[model samples]
Target: MDHDHVRDVDPAVADALEGELERQRSTLQMIASENHVSRAVVDAQGSVLTNKYAEGYPGSRYYGGCEYADEVEQLAIDRAAELFGAEHVNVQPHSGTQANQAVYFAMLEPGDRILSLDLTHGGHLSHGHPANFVGQLYEVEQYEVDAETGYIDYDGLEEQAAEFDPDIVVSGYSAYPRDIDWERIQDVADDVDALHLADIAHITGLVAAGVHSSPVGIADFVTGSTHKTIRAGRGGIVMCDEEYADDVDAAVFPGGQGGPLMHNVAGKAVGFEEALQPEFEEYAEQTVANAKALGETLADEGFSLVSGGTDNHLVLVDLRESHPDTSGGDAEVALEEAGIVLNGNTVPGETRSAFDPSGIRAGTPALTTRGFDEDDCRKVGELIARVIDAPDDEAVKAEVREEVEALCAANPLYEDD
Candidate 1:
């Protein structure tokens, strides 16, 4: 983490890199889509593989001198298949969005219909948001979570599918806390004779550890980011049965991207190896436990938790009901000032703009990676409530900052650095 060579070349960039490392070490990283990767993964990501260009899958590349590249990419593909129990795997997409793009390009035509969850109700932009290419390229329809229960309205989704008759039905979510019924979504897709794409970008590690229900065999295509819960550096993966393997591979390579990020593929290989260890399962279980503890503590402090709690790694807090005056953006800024890092998120039935939504989303993956337990998460929740309760109070923020420093000291991150 010293960045000695970087300092010798460019002192300013070196300072920023060192500062980022220190920031992660000092603050509470509770962002749901973020996690801390092991040093081995970091080293692999910074490896000399970055200098190489592997244009195609293993043993079938268009370029020469791809011997080592073939080996590393095949290792990543094999490990990901073992972890997810998929017949075929592609580890080339630069991100989860690109992974989704591959699936769309492989199976969809221009003007084909796509039905997915709404962005404000726990969906992703790649699913069908007008701002993204997917929305622009396809005829898109959206479904929502039940207003009363704060859960996906499966029945409503079924009806929407019947009317929209989509070519593909996208499942999985971003901010929703409850476990998804993949079979139910698959049934809807089946009835419509449509393909199902399950994006588990937020819970790849949890699924790998058998802590979350997998959609590998059930959905037509399963896609995810290698980071997030997996801590597998930074990349995206797509898994499907062998029948669609060639289509997915070609779509990922020639259709969406050219040369894969070889260094990131190396990182994924290392991180996947690390995740196969028994301890990673414990880490996954503890991450969910910590999220539950955090939600309970926040609920006790009078913060309204969406869906009443969480089933995975994150808890979504709707601030409009409890703290009518404080916006999620307001709480986000104040919490950052107090060294607690999380995001202001849009709730199910969002009343405010996405920029300053009514909710805050927090998770426990990074904290659990740093050896935090349920009790530690509860204390962190209390600190969050305090900051949210009096966002404008400098004295309260100062006190919470001190407590945050103590927590960081107790549960050190990147200590070896």
Candidate 2:
């Protein structure tokens, strides 16, 4: 991870880069939408492709000197298509938000109706939060997870879709933990003659590995972040049937962005190649297993889990029931001090502000990438429970920090450094 070239050019930026690497090595990154990419992916993202500008798809570039860029981009596309069984893949959007934007741009016009999950109920801002451009552009109506069950109410959504008569229906989620019934959502869209866009940004790898059901074939459009559970470098991807391939490609390129980030495309290619290995399936399985173990441990410690459990790599713990006085932010701060890192998130039926929510969201992707298993995750959960239960206790914080350090040592990340 040495940045000798960057150090020679700008020592300050180099120090920050090295510091970030150190921070990741030391902390437990349980942020639900994040994961650690392999060193190979890192290397590819740091390659010479960053200097190239390929503004169009392979075989049809707007610039010269795109032969290598074409190769890398094509590799990414091929690997991703095979991974998800998508008829078409556009690995060009700069981020997950942009991926969603591409879908909207391709399918809908200004003021067209968009039906999506409510942000506080585990949906993404890009889906239609007032703060985002999509919300400003589209007439948005939001659905919600069941207050009592913490799952999507499909029948309710169907009824809402019929009433709203939206131009597009967005499925998949950001913070919700259970497996989605893509077909149910798609059926709702179909009945209303609306387009279905499934944003699997958080579970790209899980879907690819068959641990979660995919929306590639069922939904009209599918988009995801490459960096999350997929373990690619930072980027986004869009998949659709051949019928909409040109539209998606155009939307991702001239509609939303100019040149493709070829370096990130290279990283995506390498990571997707790694995911095609037999071991990655085991990794996906272990990731879900670890989440279950962590959630169970938290449940045993009196923490109320959303949905009472998880079917994926993430678990959302609502603190309102057990620790009425402590906000999710309060627990987040204390846990970080103890070397455990995760975010405070808005839970279903949230009674607090988004800035300081009632629940903490944890995920197993990064820890699993660092070789953590069910036992290790359970131990981490125990540490989390301790901190949340006694956030002001210095003695408990110290003990938990020591244990976190031991776990980090046991599963070393980037040891070459």
C-alpha TM-scores of all predictions: 0.99, 0.99
Tens digits of per-residue lDDT, candidate 1, 115-187, equal: 9999998899999999999999999999999966888988999999999999999998888899899999999
Model 1 ranges with Cα > 4 A deviation: none
lDDT of each: 0.95, 0.94
Residues 1-417, candidate 2, lDDT per residue (tens digit)? 798999999999999999988888888999988898888998999999999988988999999999999999999999999999999999999999999999999999999999999999999999999999999999999999998999999999999999999999999899999999999999999999999999999999999999999998999999999998998889999999999998888888899999988999999999999999999999999999999999999999999999999999999999999999999999999999999999999999999999999999999999999999999999999999999999999999999999999999999998877
The local distance difference test score of model 1 is 0.95
Give the range of the ten consecutive residues with the poorest summed lDDT in model 1: 146-155
lDDT of 1 at 103: 98
Which runs of model 2 end up more than 4 angstroms from their true locations? none
Candidate 2 at residue 165, lDDT? 99
